[model samples]
Each structure stands twice: as C-alpha cells, then as structure tokens.
Target: MIQLTVNGKPRKADVDPDTPLLWALRDSLLLTGTKYSCGSGLCGACTVHVDGQPVRSCITPVSAVAGKKVTTIEAVDGSRVGKAVQEAWRKLDVVQCGYCQSGQIMSAVGLLSKNRRPSDADIDAAMAGNLCRCATYVRIRAAIHEAAKALA
Candidate 1:
C-alpha cells in the first residue's frame, strides 16, 4: 500500500510503486480532475501540486510522492491563491476547449502562489510547459494578471 496525503486527506493506494501518480489519483483515489495527455510529461494536462509545487502527474511515480501532500484541481479552490486564480479564470473566460483548463489553472495557481505579481515574461516562462490547443494564451495571461491583482 502506498500512502500519501491528497487534498488534505490521508489516503492509500493499493498499486505498484512505479504506477504513475495520475492513475493512482484517477483510478485508486478517484480524483479525476487531473487530466492525462502526452503521458510523457511533455504536456501539462496532468499537473498537480506535490508539496505546493506543480508537477506532471502522468510521469510521476506514486512512490515518488509517498508521504507528501498532493493537491489536485478538485481541491485547488480551497486555497486563497487558487480561489483568486479560478475566479479570474472564470471572469476572464479563460477556457477555450476546457480540456486543458484544469492543468492551466493548476499551473497558474502554482505560479501565483509563489509570485504574487508576475510580468508577462514571468507568466510565459512559468506557463511554458502547459499547452492550450485552442490558443487562449491571451486570456490566460489576462486571467493570471487579474488573479495577481486580486491577490494583491
């Protein structure tokens, strides 16, 4: 049994240690908000917070995060930064196709949690790994700025 804290709750997953954290989250723990795309971790669809840092769950082994805290999109709104980012995302209509928004939101929250104010360059650098098929980069950047303002 692999033990970890997810969304502030203690949980156990009866899976192989090498199993990707994404499967453990989606299959074992039933937290399906974290998406699976480009399983090689090239895309940010599987982004989640492990110890307050965003990580690609699709390529991360469950064992790698053992005994650590793993936060997913489902619980992101619980944080102040997350709530601000999500509110900005909604207000700015940042969702294009919605498939990548969860990851995008996760990454945005990650960026804002550490840096209260991020310039366009900082936003681009931080969000470089996340891909949006609909090309909503403008709105995403706007939402990040809005969220930063709200946070301030």
Candidate 2:
C-alpha cells in the first residue's frame, strides 16, 4: 500500500505504486474533479495542486506524491480564491459543455493565487495546456480577471 494526502485527508491505496494519481483520485478516492485528458501530460485537464503548486496529475504517479498534500478541484473550490473563481465563472457563464471546466477552474485558481493580477498573456501561459472543446476562452479569461479583482 502507498500512502498519500489528498485534500487534507490521509489515505492509502493498495494499487500499483506507479498508478497515475489521476486514476487513484478518481477510481480509488472518488474525487473526480481532476479530469483525465491527454494522459501524456500535454493536457492540463488533470491539474491539481501538490503542496500548493499546480501539477498535471495524469502523468504523475501516486508514489511521486508519497507525503505531499494533493488539492483537487473539489477541495480547492472552498477556498477564498477558489470561491472567487467559481463565483466568477458563474457570473460570466464561463462553462460550455462542462466537461473541461473543472480543470479550467483548477488551473485558473492556481494562476490567480500566485498573481492576483495577470495580463492576457499571463492567463494564456497559465492556461496553455487546458483545452476546452466548447471554446469558452473569452469567458474563461473574463472570469479569471474577475476572480483576480475579487481576490484583490
């Protein structure tokens, strides 16, 4: 069994040490907010914060986070910045199709926490890997900016 901390809770899984955290989170822990897209790490759909730093969980092994705190979208949405992001998303109606919004919100929260004010290029860089099929880029950008102002 391998041990890891997720969303402030400690848990263990009796799976392969090399199992991707994305699987462990969705399958084992039942925390499905972090998505699986482009499992090779090119996609940010599986973004989560490990020790407060956003990481692509699709390519990250559970063992790699042996003692680290993993913050998924579920837990993150309850925070100050996170709540702002969620509220902004709703206010701007940033989601379309809804499949990738979780990941998008996760990435946005990660970016806004570090930089309360981000330019369009900064938002692009922070959200570069997350692909949205419905093309809500304009709304996503607007939500992020609104969330930043809310945080500030």
Candidate 3:
C-alpha cells in the first residue's frame, strides 16, 4: 500500500509501485481534476503540487510520493491564492475550449503562490509548459497578473 496525503486528506492505495500518480489519483482516489494530456510529462496538463511544488503527476510514480502531500485543482479554492486565481480566471474569461484550463489554472496558481507579483517574463517562463490550443495565452497572463494584484 502506498501512503500519501491528497488534498489535505491522508489515504492509502493498493497498487503497483510503478503506477503513475495520475492513475492513482484518477482511478484509485477519484480525483480527476489533474488532466492527462502528455503522458511523458512534456505538457503541464498533469501538474499537481507535491509538497507545494508543482510536479507532473503523469511521470511521477505513486511510490515516489509516499507520505508526501499532494494537492490537486479540486482543493485549490481552499487557499487564498487559489481562490484569487479562480476569480481572476472567471473575471477575465480565460477559457476557450476549456479542455486545458484546469491545468492552466493549476500552473497559474503554482506560479502566483511563489511570486505574488510576477512580471510578463516571469509569467511566460512559469506558464510556458502549459499549452492551450485555443491560444488564450494573453488572457491567461492577464488573469495571473490580476490574481497577483488581488492577493496583494
């Protein structure tokens, strides 16, 4: 059994040691907010916070996170920064097709948690890995800046 804390709740899962955290989350734990776009970890769709640092869950094994804290988009609104990010996303209307918005928001929240006032370059660098086929980069950047202001 692999032990871990997900969205602030302690849990255990009986699965292969090599099972990707994404599967453990989506299948075992039933937390599907974390997407599975690029299984190789190239895309940021599977981003989740492991001990408050954004990590690609698709490439992370369940055994690797034993006894660690895992935070998903489901619990993001529980924090001030996350709520601000969600509000900013809504006010800015940053979603187009919305397939990748969760991941985008996850990345945005991760960036804002560390840097409250991120510059254009900072936002770009932080969000570079999260691809939005709808091409909503402008709105995403604006929402990140807006969330930073709200958190300030």
Q: Residues 27-129, candidate 3, lDDT per residue (tens digit)?
A: 9999988999979988888999899888899999999999899999999999999999999999999998987888888889889999999999999999988
Off by over 4 Å in 2: none
Show pairs that collide, candidate 3.
Answer: none
* lDDT scores of the candidates, listed in order: 0.95, 0.90, 0.92
* RMSD, candidate 2, Å: 0.9
Q: Which scores greater on TM-score, model 2 or model 3?
A: 3
For residues 41-106, could you state the per-residue lDDT of candidate 1 as single tens digits?
Answer: 987999999999999999999999999999999999999999999999999988978998889999
Cα TM-score per model: 0.99, 0.96, 0.97
Ranking by lDDT: 1, 3, 2
Residue lDDT tens for model 2, 59-89: 9999999999989998987789999999999
- Candidate 2 lDDT score at position 7: 87
Clashing pairs in 2: none
TM value for model 1: 0.99
Cα displacement (angstroms), candidate 2, residue 9, comes to: 1.0
Every model's Cα RMSD, please?
Answer: 0.5, 0.9, 0.8
